[model samples]
Target chain A: MLKRLAEVLRGMGHRIIDRIWRLGSGARFFLYTLIYSGESFRRIHLTIREIYFTGVMSLLIILVSAFFVGMVLALQGYNTLQKYGSSEAIGVLVALSLVRELGPVVTALLFAGRAGTAITAEIGLMKTTEQLSAMEMMAVSPIARVVAPRFWAGVVSMPLLAALFSMVGVLGGYLVAVPVIGVDNGAFWSQMQANVDFQADIVNGVIKSVVFGVACTMIALFEGFDAPPTAEGVSRATTRTVVNSSLAVLGLDFILTSFMIVT
Target chain B: MERTTMDLWVGIFAVAGAAALFGLALKVGNLTSSSVGDTYTVTAAFENIGGLKPRAPVKSAGVVVGRVDNIQFDSKTFEAKVTLKVDKRYPFPKDTFANIYTAGLLGEQYVGLEAGGDEQPLKDGDKISHTQDAVVLEKMISQFLYNKASESDDSKKAE
Candidate 1:
């Protein structure tokens, strides 16, 4: 019995040490990626190409989702506010909720599902196919030439996509509130304009999107780079990118929101 | 996509995004500074300031003319003292009534300036002698309940 207990204790200790080693190496990989990112600026064309893939391609999903989200917000908001005899405040409700919270959050989640998965899958495939090794053999750091552009692309795409989502959402709210619901258009818009502050709502949202962009992209690149050179590994990495990014976005949202409200 | 075509599309995307952001700021967020000119500060005193915070809108005739700059309680008077930042251009008369008003019935409290028919324009550091405090809903309810209880006691005695 003592022998068995000692064996179990040794296994647990080894597992803990292994986990720490993996975490340290992961941190090292992130720093290396950051150090080599300057090469991406020199290769501006590549970054732009990545942007087209990440931002422009993802625009459709972002737009559609935002529109639906906006309509729902207006519908739900009208139902609640109308009971208070203040249906006119629905515009404020829709705009504030979208611009301040939902727009950045939903856009990041969609970007993760769309562009983030593509990034992880593409990178993991490259690693699996020995393309990353081939580049290294040619004296090129794959982190600079490959990973950095994709990283920058995602970071740039997030805020732009979020902004577009908010603008489109406000439009959707208008469509439903004014035409379908037969609410006064002037009141819907004017109340929103009067209440929401540019610095407080819009700028802070942009900040949030940018932070989420960086975080999501980092997780995607890290998971992709670390995946094993196998089909199952690449698929797992893609799944991890989506799952991890969504959780990260939600977690960061709570922390950032508390800070934003205070400041 | 070709390099030039890619650049063009990216450019368009960026421009459109920026334009939308600008429009959001202007239309929905009121990002642009109010058309009001340089502003000056004034102060007001209230008995109770319910749910009023700094940067809350200060309005006149239903138009936002300024913002609440600061709020402090006077140790001597034990009343909430609020400082107002009013636009220099929209000068109010000396007799302008500075009153705490609630928006949307149960919404936030703001200072509403009702311009009194006085030709004399108020200046910086001047206090409007006329002021009204916020009406606390809880206090009103409690008072009503007290009155009802007293009336019931009076009826019991009569019986």
Candidate 2:
């Protein structure tokens, strides 16, 4: 019984040690990616191509989701705000929530599932097919040619996507509130403008999106790079990318929010 | 996809994203309205500034002419020192009354600058002395209750 208990403890210790070792390597990989990013910028075409894949391709889903989210927010906010005879304030509600929290967060979550997963799978597959090995053998740093461009693309795309989300979301709310719900159109726009500060709300949301972009892209890159060169491994890494990116976005959001609120 | 097509899509996406950000700033946020140009900083001290926060609008005759820039407690004087940044164009007189007022029934608190009949305009770093504290709802309610109670007591005594 004591030996069995000792074995359990040993297993736990092994996991903890392995996690720490992986974290250390991930940090090193991130550093390498950053160092190699100069090549991606110099090439410009590589990063632009990645942006087309990551940013332009993801626009449709982001816009659709943002619209629905806004409409839902208006529907729900009107329900509660009407109790206080302040249904006009629904504009403030939707804009504030979307700009301050939902826009960055939802965009990041969706980006992780969409672009992040694609990035992981693509990289993992490249590894599985010995493409990465071939590139290395050719004396080319794959980090510069492949990873850095994708990383920079993600970082650029996230804030823009988040901004688009917020803009579309406000329009969605306006649609539902004004025409559908019979709210005054002027009040909807004016109230939103009155309450939402550019520096405090919109700028902060952009900052959050930038941070999420860095975290999500790096997490996906690390997972793909670390995955074993196998079919099952690649699939697992893709799954892990989504899961870890989401958790990281949420956790970082809380920390960032705390810091922002104090400021 | 072709490189040209990809480039075109990315270009469109970048422009759209930038436009969205600009739309958000102009249409959905108070960026345009809140840009009071070339501000002159002035200070006001209040005995109580209930819920008066930084960036709260400073309106003159219901038109926002400035903003509250800072709020600090003066331990020595037991007053809240509020620093305001008013637009240079809309200068206030030295004897202007800075009264804290609520916008609506339950809206945010802001400072109302009631210009006074003074010859000299207030300059930067100047202090406005005639300031009114924010109206505390609890104090108002209690005062109303006390007045009602006293009136009832007077009626009973008369009876």
Candidate 3:
């Protein structure tokens, strides 16, 4: 019986390896399709819709959350700084923390949870329903039609959304510091302005957001395309997409920070 | 196909608009107040640097004139020694005083300098004679509250 169990386990391992190899090959095919395509107009349209949905549509929530985050940072920073009587540096601390780290990362994770899950589930459902197969049968490349649009959308939307998040967060910090925490508005903005450098923090944030967007879209599309042909499979794919995308965003953030240090 | 063409144009416009806005915001932020470019080096001796870090701004008269470049311990003095980059244009007189000041109620600490004297200018690598260490706010507040409560207790006993 033990010998039989060992044999089964070995078989399962072989199957898993074979499955991973197949998935890798499929990914390569998708990459080739993207590279060979000349459908610039189609890609642009897809990207625009993605920006509208992922950025414009999600603006309200991102702004609200950023505002609160900024305010809390300022309040907390102010409380601590008041001890040594250098309360004016609150702006610099808030701006640096938000622009350099928190703003882009938090916004990307939020986007992954919302748009990333939706795209995965939508694609998975279409696959299970035979819509994707029907498109292929009709000589339409699903790679260009489905995957390209979502990929471009994520790439286009991420930077815009991240910028908005940072702005709102700064404003939030300003409100908290000036009114609630009793720091002067001029002092707050002045300190922030004095410390923040556009090249180092802002540009770095935008670059990070773009990379995050690409990772999120790719993970979602991959999970959706590989879903099992069942109702349960679509649900599982959606769950996996969100989990994977969130983890990927965090992982990429660390890698990007390390890379930024070197560059 | 026609819709795709229009969308393409729209995407271009949107990207351009976002980029323009971001540029404008950055310009405005820079215009209102900007970092000091002049750099001078000053050293301070501290019993404890605490969590002080590099890239921390060094300010004079509530305006940043430089940054903390490095921190190390002096074996002979048994104190943490900090190296500062002050703007070269902002002349530090011979008797300038440096103190570690915290921002807001819970913010990061920075080195604050008070310019002193009408005599000789401080040269590069000159040590600031006086240094006030970081005063942690929470500890002070708690102490103040404790003292207030004890005073109230004394008054109640006398009554």
Candidate 4:
């Protein structure tokens, strides 16, 4: 029994050490990935291709989701503000909520599900099939040639995606509030214009999305690069990318909003 | 997708996104609307300002013509002094009545100018002497309750 206890303690200690080592390696990988991004400038076409895959492919879902969110916001806000005879402020409610919160968040979540998963699966496949090894044999840095362009692409595309989401959302809100809900056309717009500040709502939203883009892209690349060379590993990596990206987006949003609003 | 097609789509996406963003900034955010064109400044004083802030819209007959630039308190007169910046296109008469008006029942307060028929157009650095204070709902409710209580007490004594 004493010998068994010693073995179990030793196993636990080994597990802890392994976990710490993995974490340190992961940090090193992250630093190397960022450092190699400087080499991505000359390879703008590669970045564009990745942007097409990640951003363009994710656009439909983002637009649809944002539209519904805005519609719902306008509908619900109109109902609540109606009682107070201030239904005109529905524009304010919908626009502010979408620009500040829903636009970046929903876009990021959908991006994770669609583009992020694809990125992990593709990279994991490349690694699994020895494509990465082949590149390494040729003295081509995979981090610079493959990962950096994709990372920079994601970062570049995210703000544009978020902006499109918000603009489309505002349109959706307009449609529901102005025509369907019978909100005063002039009042709705005027109240919204009077209330929402460009610096406070729009700029802050862009900043939030930029931060989320970096975080989500980093998580995707990490999961892909860290996955073992197997089909099952790639599948698991894709799942992890989606899950981790979602959590990161939501968590980063909360922190960013706290800072943005307080300041 | 073909590389050229993808590139074209991306260019469109980026440009459209930028245009939409600019529109949002201009329309909803009201960035381009303020501090553009020509504007002149005038000052008004009131007994109570009531949650009014700088950058609040200054409306005339439901049309936004200017914005509140600043607010200061006068010690001797015991009044709130408000600086109004009016667009040059919208020149108000000398006898314009500036009143602090709330948009809705429980909405943001702004300065609503009731244009008076004076031949002379008000210029920069002019003082709007005729001003009205903001309505304090809490104070008004308390006064109303006090009035009702006193009325009930007087009626009881009479009986």
Among these predictions, the greatest DockQ belongs to 4
- Per-residue lDDT of candidate 3, residues A1-263 (tens digit): 99999999999999999988967975785585467345634556565665566556666677788889988998889889888788888888888888778878988888878788888888898899999999999988777777777777777777777777787788788888888778887777766764676677777887898888778878887888888979999899899888888898899999999998788
- Candidate 3 is graded, for docking, as incorrect
User: Where is model 2 chain A poorest over a 10-residue stretch in terms of lDDT?
Assistant: A186-195
Candidate 2 vs candidate 3, TM-score winner? 2
Evaluating just chain A, the predictions reach TM-scores of: 0.95, 0.99, 0.89, 0.93
Error of 3 at B26 (Å): 2.1
Q: How well docked is model 4, in DockQ terms?
A: 0.74
Against the true structure, candidate 4 has what lDDT? 0.90
- Ranked by DockQ from best down, the candidates are 4, 2, 1, 3
lDDT by residue for model 4 over B1-159, one digit each (tens)?
Answer: 789999987787779778878878987797876786889999999999999998888999988899998999999999999999999999999999999999778888999999899999999999998998999999999999999999999999999
Q: In model 2, which residue pairs have backbone atoms overlapping below 3 Å?
A: none
RMSD of 2: 3.5
For B1-159, candidate 2 gives per-residue lDDT tens digits of 899999999999999999999999999998886665789999999999999988788999988798898999999999999999999889889999999998776777899999999999999999999999999999999999999999999999999
Tell me each candidate's TM-score. 0.87, 0.85, 0.66, 0.94
Model 3 superposed RMSD (Cα): 7.9
**Candidate 1, residues B1-159: lDDT per residue as tens digits?**
578988998888888788878888988886554544689888998888888887778999888899888999999999888999998879999898999998878666789999999989899999877898888899999999999999999999999
Report the CAPRI category for model 2: medium
Q: Give each prediction's DockQ, rounded to 2 decimals.
A: 0.56, 0.59, 0.11, 0.74
Worst 10 residues of 4 chain A by lDDT: A35-44
In lDDT terms, how accurate is model 3?
A: 0.78
Each model's RMSD to truth, in Å?
Answer: 3.0, 3.5, 7.9, 2.2
lDDT against the true structure, per candidate, is: 0.90, 0.94, 0.78, 0.90
Better of 2 and 4 by TM-score: 4
Candidates 1 and 3 compared: the better one by lDDT is 1
Best by the TM-score measure: 4
